[model samples]
Target: MKILFHVLVSSILLVSCGSSKQLNENKNSLTKEINKIYQENVFNGFAVSIVDEKGTLYQQGYGFADISTKKEYTNNTIQNIASVSKTLVGVALQKAQELGKINLDDPIEKYLDFNVSNPNFPNEKITIRQLSNHTSSIVDNEFYLSKNYYLKSNQDLTNVKLNFDEEQVFNPSDMKISLQKFLKNTLEKNGKWNKDSFSKNAPGTIYEYSNIGTTLAAYIVEKATGETFQNFTKKNILQPLKMDQSGWTFQDVDFSKFSKLYESPTTLLPFYEMVTYPDGGFITSVNDLSKFLSELIKGYNGNGKILSKESYKEYFHPQLSATNFIERNTQNPYNESYNVGNFIGYGYTGFIGHTGGDPGVLSMMFFDPKTNIGRIMILNTNFSNKKGNDAFYGIWNILEKYQDKLIK
Candidate 1:
């Protein structure tokens, strides 16, 4: 009996060692495959992370964070992750609800100090749920591009060529104003900076992506929780998850670690900020985002810590139906506009996460519910042409191919 037990233990140990060896070998193979694609040079600097509910399976960065300085991008390199930042707003809303501060069904006007009714349907009440699902009928107008962006206070605009065609205009840094003032002016009835900010449809009747509407929802969180949006999120989301390297504004992070954004492999963009930051501005490293994604996976699995499991369920619940979209994106498997839950999005092919693009930035973060595995990509350069698009998806596809092997 003693001899049999010894043999059994030895067999288990041998199998375990073999499996570990195979996993490490697979990781190396994944790195080599990804590195090959990186040679295409479609983006200046980018980071990719693969994570499971337990933790990160793999995280890496490639290329130059600063080409002139010869600074290599690493997992700790930080950049603003455009609209992917909206997911944190969703999480923040759920946390506030868990604390009994607000309800999703409440009319947004209840907590607002200013009026914001659709000009076409003044009496139709817009609910918080509508904003979360992109059914509020609030549209980002031309002013959204023309007025929201401002250059960093320190940037010297001596030789920076503003791309008007792309609506990449950066106002002088001193013109940067408060979020409330910006939203109130853009969203209020006949307020300054207001244009065609509302669609013809009634509130909660159609899908219209509204960055202003999202910022308004974040403002509502401030009113209900009696906290600044930045502080509230830092305390409830960042602190709880230990995302020390992420922040809503420039002041909260180590600016030295921030990556310089690119218009092309050779053209650099001046640092800038948006007045309606809640809509897209989130500064973070791939390492920090990997931690956040892992928590989201855990939340989906009903073992999360930041918010109750019930809140997580609500956070992931699909809120839009077929009628909500006039034309749903069926071809693009990664299109987040197909559906929305809270502030996060559901892709056409059932991926849950969000995608964001801004001046010199592109970001995508999604997780498969069935597999409980997630992937994230953040690029410092913009991609509009087919070659860049293909290369972007190429890295994502390679990660997908290897995620299963790394899943333990």
Candidate 2:
């Protein structure tokens, strides 16, 4: 009996040790794959996080915060997330509902002091829901895409520089209009695009991705809460997440810890600012963003620390798809795979997130509700480098291709 007992215990110990060894091996493999990507020198810097319902499973920052300074980028290095900033605004809008600030079904013009209506469909009002879903019929015109507007922005105060070639481009000090003023010109009846910006279709009739729609969400937050979008998001979201290093404007980030936007492994790009800060203006770290991503993943499974169950549903439920009520489904002039969801876009079947890009920056963040898995990838490089990974655009394109096998 004593001999048998010893053998049983030894066998159990061996099995336990073997299991641990295999788990470590798997984790090491994933890390090695990520390291391989980092060593490729595709972009100057990147901060990534992979998570599930429980919490962050992996996170690392590669390269330098500023190559000139030789400062290393860590899991905590904060940088602009581009349009991925919209997801943060999505959750904030849900919180606004919890705070009894506004309803999703409310007409957006009800919150804005200015009138924003589709000139072609003047009788049909654009609701907060339509804006969140990218079905508001608003379009981006020359002004939204013009460099001259940004040249005149407050961002010009700092002799901003940009690199796009192993490339670079400097920020121009040239705009006379504030964000609100620009919105007035584009959204109000007398505004330049009031007639042109509105698509031929009626409001909420189709999915026309708009930066204007996302920024309006932040504006509504301000209009309803009577606080600027930055302050309100800080007090309610950043503070609670203990993301002290995150903020909207340049003044909010600690330059010592901030990563320079880059086009190549060595090139740096000057920053751009927008009065429409809510759309894609946030600067955040992997650690801080992971905290928020976990909350979102948790919400995907039903409840989250920040958003309640009903609010979560309202924020994530898919609103339009080819099989659904969309009148017209164009090839998404930018990226056809891009689809619309409630206040955000669907990355995949179970994903509700957003993508972002600028002259030299590209980013993606999305969470799968069914698997409770989430991934975030940001490259100081834009979509121009579309050669490898079988014509994939950036780091995100490759990461997403191997998301499951590489992340787990």
Candidate 3:
């Protein structure tokens, strides 16, 4: 193992010469495969970064960041990372633990002013770990706060789908004023689905992938430290790690460097106005996100910029049963991803990542704790049910096909 204590001392990166030739060959192969995929698919733009414990091995971008001005997308072009932000929240809580603010295994109610409990399982108290791993048994409608809710059975790991009427759409403006405020309403007593939202299944037993579960976790961090999630993450994770190109809001980023989003190759999508910001509101660049990913790789190797080595292991540990991850879940596809090996494989981690998708976005961020290697990818366009071998999730498949080849 190439354990470098010097990385702990400074952010100055080291590159090993062992696989220089193969690394170049892998890069060439990846570029060709990626080009072929993007050429055949209708994508506005995409950015990707690959890294190990030492530093970034490859970072690149394709297509146009701003089609109006014909600006070519590059590594610094920022985009809203969608649900991948959950991992950021997970890491923040780890920092909160280091600061003696909260414990992952402790009941989440202890951190909040409001009582958070599943009414069906009233006596059961949810823990921070469950929330992080999506086994909290708190079902999320991710839209309306009432009705359409179900309990997570230990047997189900896929995200639960509710029977919402086609016309019964939701508006972000109608939700809570802030993410913290939203959690208070959604997870507390007398709240919209206070009773219905809580599952009969006990907390820490079932794996129901939830955006609300993670948003609540972020709120717990805020309650424990008396600070907003954005400010806390900026102060502790982003700034400390020197991910200067990343932020939780518009004010933290350079508008000129931002990539315009799209619903399709030619269709446009507005920038995000987040009601549940903590769940999917992080905006960052391949360069900045690479720095964060690099630190995580370092953390798994027992050396990190912000989170301790132990925290890294704990945060990335699998939260579901082996069978739950042996086959990928289509419903909660954002929280985990697998290689294109007939069956999707988590390769030792189902919680280390949070893939993202919306009108015009398809993104992924994942790392293997054992090998200290990971990837961050974002696309400004969303393609569905395309007809080909590498149609929709080509980026993931590409990385999976060459993961070992690219990792030095």
Candidate 4:
């Protein structure tokens, strides 16, 4: 019996050693392939993370976070994630519901002082659920793009080259407006910025992607919980997940670690903030976001920490049917608009997560339910042509090809 026990122990040790060796080999190969793509890419800086339900499997950052200063972009480098921030809104909404502060079905008017009636459908009462699913009939008008962005206060813009699209204008810092005022002006029936702000479809009938609509949902969470949306999320989600490096605004994070966003490989953009920040404007590092993604995967599997299982169910539930969309994106597997959960997103291929794009930023985060493995990629430079697009997806595909090999 003693001889048999010794043999079994030796066998187990050998197997463990073999597994570790194989994992290291896979990691080396993945790094090599991803580095190859980065060498030929046009973007200034970017980061990628591969995660499972438990934690990060592999993560790395490449290129220059600040090209002028030669600061390398690392896993700890932080930047705004654009619309991926909506996923946090989704999580915050569920947490609010779990605390009994609000109900998903309640009319938004119950919490808001301003009247936000869609003139096209005046009698319809838009519920929180409708706003969460992008079917609230609210539309992002011209003002959303032209008037919402402001240069960060005290920035020296004298030498900064402000290259942007026509709709992407940067207002002076003094021109900034509060989140409530911005939403009221855009969504209220009789406000200065209201112009074609509501679609012809009634609430809960058509799917229209609205940044302003998302910010409204977050604002509702604030009114219901009697707390600011930023503070509410910090206490609940960020704290619980130990995402100490992430926040909704510059005030919440270390500004020194923030990356300088690029218009092109050679052109840099002036730092700016959005008035409708809840829709997009989550600033975090890839390392911190990996923790959040892991939590989401755990939540999907009925083991989340921040929100109850019941709340997670509603948060991930597909709220839109085929009738909700006039045309669906059947091509891109990373496209989040294929369908939507509370504020979460479903791809055409059944992956669940969100994608976000803003001036000088592009980010994708998604996980497969069957495999429970996820991939995230965040770029500081904007991609406009086919070459940049191909290179971006090329790095993503490399991650997908090797993610399972890292699993043990």
Candidate 5:
């Protein structure tokens, strides 16, 4: 009897060891496959993280964080994670709602102190839900604001040669001011924009994917909390997640550690200031972001240290279907669906997050609630045209290859 029991115990131990070996082998293969894609794609700076149900299985950084300086990419190097910042803001709004500080259905006029000039929209009530879903009829006139501000500031430079069409200008500062003014104006006008000027779809009817909507949401968070948006996010989101490396502003960040923002093809541009930090203007590293995703996957409930599970669910719920046009234009083709604050996946893996891109940055973060698995990929480079598109595709392909394992 004793001999038989020993044999059985040995057999069980052997099987367990074999399974562990297989897990490690699979993880190594995933790392190799991702590295191959990084090598082939010529991505200037990139970081990828894959965490399973147990814990982080693989996290790696490849290529240079700064091409000119040849600085190696590290887990701590911060990259601007454009639209991914929205997920954080969404959580903040939900928290405020739960605290009885605001209501999702509250009108913008209730919280904001500005006046809108457009006369199309009816009913002075633009609800918080509408802003969160991008169903608010806010016209994003960043280009117009940029042009007007530039021409007004550079009146004497009219004779100076121009790169884009004289009519096409990109003014970062003016874009921010325009959004703030528009939000303030919308409140003052009692939510009266051109009827047709707003989307025909009823509020929260369909997703239009407007950065303006997100900015309004941020403004609401600030007004309700009586705190600056940046401070609110840091206190409510980043600090709780222990995401020490993330920040909405670039003021005190150590440039030596921060990944240098690159402007594609070889030129490097300093990070452009974004007025709409709520939409797409936060910076973080893969290591810190992995921690954030872990909390999200665990459905943190803002209890002791994390966001409320209820708020997390509300953010990931498919409030409305994102417009096809917006989906097609997204940085990740795999991100074909949209939720309230996130993008839903085709499978039953729950919600997959969105990606963000700008002149010198591209970022993606996705988490599966059911499986408690998540992945994040961030690259620094403003690939001029198709190059950026191709690089993003390469990253998506890498993520897709491991989707089953990552989402499991």
Candidate 6:
């Protein structure tokens, strides 16, 4: 009997050792595969995170944050996350609803002093839900593109002639202030700021993506919280998640530590201030973002600590359906169908996330709801083509190739 008991114990010990070795080998192989993908893609910098239903399985950063200085990309190396910031804003808006600070169904006019005018639109009342879902038909703020408009219109004229002789003028630093002023001025000057213009669509009729919709969200958050948008986010979302490196603006950042924006061929691009920080402006590192994703996967914290499970569910639920397919030939090739401030299931594995590009940056963040897997890619190069098709498709293909390792 004693001999038999000893034999059983020895067998159990051998099996345990074998299992440990297998686990280590699997982890090493996964890392090797990820590195291989990075090398093959020539991705300047990227951070990937894989989280299971329970928690994070892998979190790693690859390539250089600044190639010129040879600064290796660390988990803390901040990059402008672009429209992924919208997801964060959406969550905050939902939180406000939970707290009874605001109602999603409330008309935006109740919270704003400025009037939105568009006679062609059907809706007079624009709700928070519509804005969050990008169903709000508010005129796309033309002021946002005034500089682009002036530059394109006066392409033949010298800079001095364009600015001095032309009736319209633009200053990059004052762009945001100018945009707000222009909108206000145009509305007043044209007598178009009333219900006809202010309330264009009937809340939820058409699906037109609007940066103004998100800017309204930021404005509402500020009004409801009695705090600046940045402070409220920091106090509520960032602090709770322990995402120490994220911020809404440069003033809130450590300028020296921030990664210098770069373009292809390693040219540094001028840092233009994002007029609408709520829409596509916050910056963060992959390490902190991984933490954010992990929390989101667990339904805003494993135990519903930050946002209740119901709130999270509501946030991720598809709010709009494609009445029809829309096609565009842009720098990136995509047949994207939008539903409520998100790009749903574009690439392989039907990963849900947003992609953003402006000037010298391109970014993507996708997280699978069923599998709790997530991937993010941020590139400094603009990949300029008449149509920006290559930039989007290229990144999508790269993500698809790694789907097995990332998702499963």
Q: Please write out the lDDT profile of model 4 over residues 1-408, one tens digit for every residue.
A: 999999999999999999999999999999999888888858889999999998999999999898888899999999999999999999999999999999999999999989998997789999999999999999999999888888888776765766488778988889898998998889887889999999999999988988989999999999999999999999999998899999988899999999998888887889988998899899999999999999999999999999888999999999888899999899998898899999999998999999999988999999999999999999999978998989999999999999999998
TM-score of 5: 0.78
Tell me model 5's lDDT, rounded to 2 decimals.
0.64
For candidate 3, write residues 249-311 as lDDT tens digits.
777888689787766666665554456667777888988888887887787677887877777
Candidate 5 segments exceeding 4 Å error: 1-21, 116-118, 144-202, 300-305, 321-333, 336-351, 384-391, 403-408
Candidate 4 scores a C-alpha RMSD against the true structure in Å of 1.1
Candidate 6 lDDT trough over 10 residues, lowest sum: 150-159
Q: List the global CA lDDT of all models.
A: 0.90, 0.70, 0.69, 0.92, 0.64, 0.60
Ten contiguous residues with the weakest lDDT in model 4? 154-163
Error of 6 at 195 (Å): 16
Better of 1 and 4 by lDDT: 4
* lDDT of residue 65 for candidate 3: 91
lDDT of 2 by residue, 36-88 (tens): 76676666667777777777776777777776777777988777787888888
Question: Cα lDDT for residue 193, model 4?
Answer: 95
**Model 1 Cα displacement at 286 (Å)?**
1.0
Clashing pairs in 4: none
Q: lDDT-based ranking, best first? A: 4, 1, 2, 3, 5, 6
Clashes of 4: 0
Per-residue error at 135 for model 2, in Å? 1.3
How close is every model to the real structure, measured as TM-score?
A: 0.97, 0.83, 0.79, 0.98, 0.78, 0.77
Error of 5 at 145 (Å): 7.3
Comparing 3 and 4 on TM-score, the stronger one: 4
lDDT of 1 by residue, 1-408 (tens): 999999999999999999999999999999999899888888888999999988999999999898888899999999999999999999999998899999999999899999989889988999998998888988898878888888888765655556534665788888878888888888888688888889999999788888888988999999999999999999998998899999988899999999988888877788888888998999999999999999999998899989899999999999889998888888877889898899998888899999999888999999998899999999999877999989999999999999999965
